[model samples]
Target: MARCFDGNKLVIASHNKGKVREIGELLAPFGVETVSAGDLGLPEPIEDGLTFIANAEIKALAAAKAANLPALADDSGLEVDALDGDPGIYSARWAGPKKDFTVGMEKIHALIKDQDNMAANFTCALTLAWPDGHMESFEGKVFGTLTWPLRGDKGFGYDPMFIPNGHAVTFAEMEPADKHAMSHRADAFKQLIAACFGDNQ
Candidate 1:
């Protein structure tokens, strides 16, 4: 069985600053030394997978193979039930190459216009890969409804528009600690930490 993260060096296989920051915070308690893909000058790999899990695994594997060390990767996106789960894997590209989520949010809001049911959710899939091709994966989701005109300015991406279930404020309005505690990424990370650490606590 693998040991807990402890204080070992680990690579966060992502170039996005937002994602890297989130993952860094999540790994803080484990005393893990986190490194981003940008730090290593690693190139982003093609994510041609059909599912979040597939994409996450591909990224983790690529990073691990390239660095010859353990790597962690996550693929997450906003999934609108009303849109037939559209923007699932293409969430990043929905706004084109500029990674502008404003256009993507607008598109989603437009699609659900005048609809009574505006249910949606955020899904996250995380993967940890080793240099020997060994790997593990976990998934999490936070259900919520869509909101209009957006709100808050604390978070990036679609955070301004997504109001999590049972909450009055959108993710963008919430503090990082609060959102991290119940976020889809956090949920998935909980599973990963448990699996890796087991009953060692």
Candidate 2:
């Protein structure tokens, strides 16, 4: 059995505005009030973890401890098969300090431009931590291929270049609600909902 989240307020442990907004939208149906770590002035902990789940837990626990409230965190990245996942965990770091996804995409394109295999995927790990030290976690992935010249002007990060399987348009080209419906984060959120909310979802 998993620990239930009966709390009304949660701290979203993320500095990325887009992530905060997406998560806030996901949690809306649960009627939970969300406050971002940035808003609360919580310091971002070093993501020294080896995996997405580890990093998510680290951030969630850090915020839960600091705020004395339940905290939710997500660590997501793009993994390219051709590069042997070179930027798997370092996806954000590849974007540089300014968090420029354009630079990140350009680097990826440079590496795999000549290669025939442009296969790639997105991975997301979500962690929920309570003030009492209990924690729950989930993970999700969306398989896709890389596109050239970068399409679309929506979605943050490397969305413009990722074309999910069976989809003609990139994530950056889809509506927010449409992307959310089939995103890796949404897959993980479904598992979290199953574990915490049971059938109520």
Candidate 3:
């Protein structure tokens, strides 16, 4: 059986406000008291991992050890098929140090080939680490196509331009609750919940 989360306190090992907020909401129903790494002033560790889960694990472990609490970390990004996943793990870096995704979005648009095959996907890797070093990881994805003239202002990241399959509007066009229902992060969270938090849910 997967290790179950039996603690009431959890540290969200991320500085991104969007991720921290979203994760906190997901954990709310379980009655977990959440604190962000940013709130604790935890330094951002080097994400030297080669893949999403590796990075997630790195962050989770770092925060878990530092906070002496269970830590949950997420590493996610958009992958463009035609571009051969150009910015998969480097998604955040593409935004530059200022975290300006608009610049990253424009760069993606400029590099797209065969606009008709603008196939892409948002990928997420979620990892939970304990201070003792044990860990659990889960991953999820949402397939979609790239859209231009980025729409809506509701979501952060590349949400303004990516439309999920069978959806008319970009992720940013949907309400927060709506996006949470089907986002890549939510997908990963579902698995994490089912495996480690099923009893609580």
Per-model C-alpha RMSD: 1.6, 0.9, 1.0
User: What digit string (tens of lDDT, one per residue) describes model 3 on residues 128-194?
Assistant: 9999999999999999999999999989999998999999999999998998999999999999999
Error of 1 at 19 (Å): 0.6
lDDT tens digits, residue span 1-201, model 2: 988888889999999999999999999998889999999999999999999999999999999999999999999999999999868889999999999999999999999999999999999999999977789999999999999999998898999999999999999999999999999999999999999976455
Among all windows of ten consecutive residues in candidate 3, which has the lowest summed lDDT?
A: 110-119
lDDT for each candidate structure: 0.90, 0.94, 0.95
Which wins on TM-score, candidate 1 or candidate 2? 2
* TM-scores vs. true structure, each candidate: 0.95, 0.98, 0.98
Scored against the true structure, residue 61 in model 2 reaches a CA lDDT of 96
Worst 10 residues of 2 by lDDT: 192-201
Off by over 4 Å in 2: none
lDDT for predicted candidate 3 compared with the true structure: 0.95
Global lDDT of model 1 = 0.90
Model 1, span 1-201: residue lDDT tens: 654444388999998899999999998877688999889999999999999999999999999999988999999999988889988888988867888889999988898888898888999999999888989899999999889998998887788889999999999999999999999999999999998845435
